[model samples]
Target: MASFLSAFSMFGMSSLGYRTGFGALFVLSVNLVPLGALWYYMHRKTFVLGRARSWMSMGMPFGERYGNGMRAVIPVVVLLASIPYLVAQVQGIGLMVEALSEKAIPYHMGMFFVPVFISLYLIMGGMKGAAWVNTVQGIFFSIMVFILFFAVMAKNGGFAPTMQMVFDTHPELFQLGAKGGKLWSYPMVFGFAAAMCLGCICFPQPYMHAYSSRTVKGFKTMLLSFGGICLVIITMPTLVGIAATVIVPGLKGVQADKVYGIVASMALPDWLAALAVAGGFTAAMSTVNGLVFGNATNLANDLLKLMVPHVGQKGLVSAARWSVAVIMAICVVIAWNPNTPVAELSVLAFGTVAVTIFPLWGAYFWKRSTAAGAMASTIVGFGINIVMFIWGGKNMVLFPSAKLFQLNGFLAAFIAAGLVFFIVCLVTKPGKIEQKSLALFFHPALDGKLDHNLVDRSENEYVKV
Candidate 1:
């Protein structure tokens, strides 16, 4: 999941540091809250709800526990959310490839190359294949960060001098409102971080990845490993971004996203710059594969199987492979003419899907969480998110005439989803169907004692209540 921080995402991270200074690190660090949430909620959810058939079954924990409505809704949302992110990864690959080859390869060609090459192996290897690739990619990106960190520090006359430069020249970036005006206020930072945490926890791909783990120990292993890896990998981009501000100042608009690439190309020797491109490639490619594979799996297992139950396991794999090819083709076209900034694109994806947070987590802990509530939260919350996105001027504002800082679309949608969930659940009692489904995730001590009441609480009883 750390690889989900694509090269474009790293670019955004660094850009955040370049513009906002130390404040950006706070946004990156809040990722752990979701990791902790995953450990507590998803780990058990996967075992209890996901273990019935193949761990990789279509509806997964959501469908198994919630009902057919959720089983249907989650796959479509997961597939849609994966698109922009896939484009971002492809765009990142295109940027670095073009830079490394000095424009010989060109952006369009590089974009095509990454998806085609990765998909070839990805189709054959599946999730387990992605696991092996991610391992190597993770190590390579880690080494890349250390090398860039030390090199940037050395070029700026060591750590103390670098800190002195930022303090003396750009100290205003640290202030909540900055010196002259507000760029990144405390509230905005909190919202962005919280949105990111929620998105990561509820994002479909990561849920599928969690389900792939064979044991509780493996799940815990992933939780710990992701936490430590994020701490190291996420911080690297910030340091590099801070260094870029000092060394290569005055980058504007889309140019700022290329800060790390520019700095590496200029500051390092030719050989190291070539290696840096490879590092970026590794980062972006790994993420692209995971996103593509996860979405493809959803399309095949969740959607197709429901349509054609006679499809065999081999047929499903073939369906997944074809889905990857088709999705990558769509992403290539989108990457060719992306107008949004890499960071905003990422944050936008998070904000849009963050509506899932309440519905997803509530299933595990909230006993009264009926399928009606889950469906309401998913549909209404997502509807509100889209409304806010348009009302906020795409990616520009929280709502009409409001700026980016105050109560953005993500927070608005998240709050709306929670309110709807609670209100709907309270007003409408759970039907016998929902009560039976809920029993799987109930506390073990409640077993046997409530079976009678659960069996007796039919739709008729619910209507009377």
Candidate 2:
């Protein structure tokens, strides 16, 4: 449990660690608008209304009663999404180590270190071991953030001068326009907002917490607190990045992701610099642990058990540990390429999940959603996103567009899939079993009872068909 909390904290912090002032400004501008609303909703649903419990209870429904077919789909998509995300985290670890140690530790060696440590602790202590390590690391990261912020501020002549310098140098960054003069285009802003919102809900790390929390209310509280922490951490890094633009304006050809490191090394004293590096490393490790564990669980619970029904609980847990090790190794190899940007990689990972599973999951409680329609929508949505990713024109592609198309792949997929679902359900008939299952899962009257009669009917109908 400690490790899990640490992992989440790291993931949240890391998201902000790489942001430069411009990037941070961009993210904050978007987040600030809806953050209050999001917080209120989460507080009411997770705490006051207890909707989080409803969300948690929905996890096992497709597995236990929807049949193995539904179960089979989850692990494949989850593993696919998790690998790149893990690779990105590993890459971040490598970059941080190389920057801090002044190349005494090669990037490749640093990459290997995270996977090795994670595999060892996870294999030895299971989730509990991982959680403890994360807890300790999370504390280290938080301290490092405050230390770095103060050090940077002092170096740049404190907050007022720092703000003045940013305003003078990069006035456009502070501007609110959406065109050539603005730092971020409207489409990029909206795309980022959509991805972040959907990503949180669909992310395996968050979902794992949902399943592991002591109660629904607890889960909601943790997420809300975590979200608030994320806003602060992300804002700080952006401020640092903005400060970097003023102090180190001539840094040529350096990507925005590396701005934080560059600023820290140039502005802070040695000890603070070292702490900054450690904080970045901690962030990467936390995200890696969460993603690797998420993949392991998906494989063990959603895939293996479904494919091989006789696998016992003990056997499944053992397999999950081994799977974590193997998956971490694969992610290490993927991280070796060292070409992709961290933000792009993160978006790609989250975009895939948002496009493929977000809508399907949302349908669980919506009474009109049909299994067949849901399946078709998922297939088409994923198919469209993949096609756009592979063949869309230079400007239209999601990742590295030559000309910005404004619309991201996930948005395209979401629209496409949602349309398909609506049309298909309107045109076709839903199975009786699906309807009964929906009612059993969503109906308030069930009061947590599994309607066995509906299950029997579903099985009988399946046999007949």
Per TM-score, the best of the predicted structures is 1
Q: Please give the TM-score that candidate 2 achieves against the real structure.
A: 0.82
Clashes of each: 0, 8
The clash tally of candidate 2 reads 8
Give the top-scoring candidate (lDDT). 1
lDDT of 2 by residue, 1-465 (tens): 222222222322233323323544565556444544453342222221122233222224444324455556656665776665677677767766665677898888877878888787777876667667778877777777677777777886898898787778767656544556443566666776666556555556655554555544455455556655666665566566566666656543213445566677887777778778677677777667777777787778767776687999898889888898889878888878766556556666666666544334434545565666666776787677667767763124343233435576667777778788777767766566566555444544323322344333433443333
Worst 10-residue lDDT window for candidate 1 reads 450-459
Worst 10 residues of 2 by lDDT: 43-52
> What residue runs in model 2 are displaced by over 4 Å at the alpha carbon?
1-23, 29-59, 64-66, 181-183, 250-256, 356-363, 392-405, 445-465
The local distance difference test score of model 1 is 0.70
lDDT of 2: 0.59
Alpha carbon lDDT of each predicted model: 0.70, 0.59
lDDT of 1 by residue, 131-216 (tens): 89988987787788778777888887987898788778888666664245566665667777776777776665566655666555
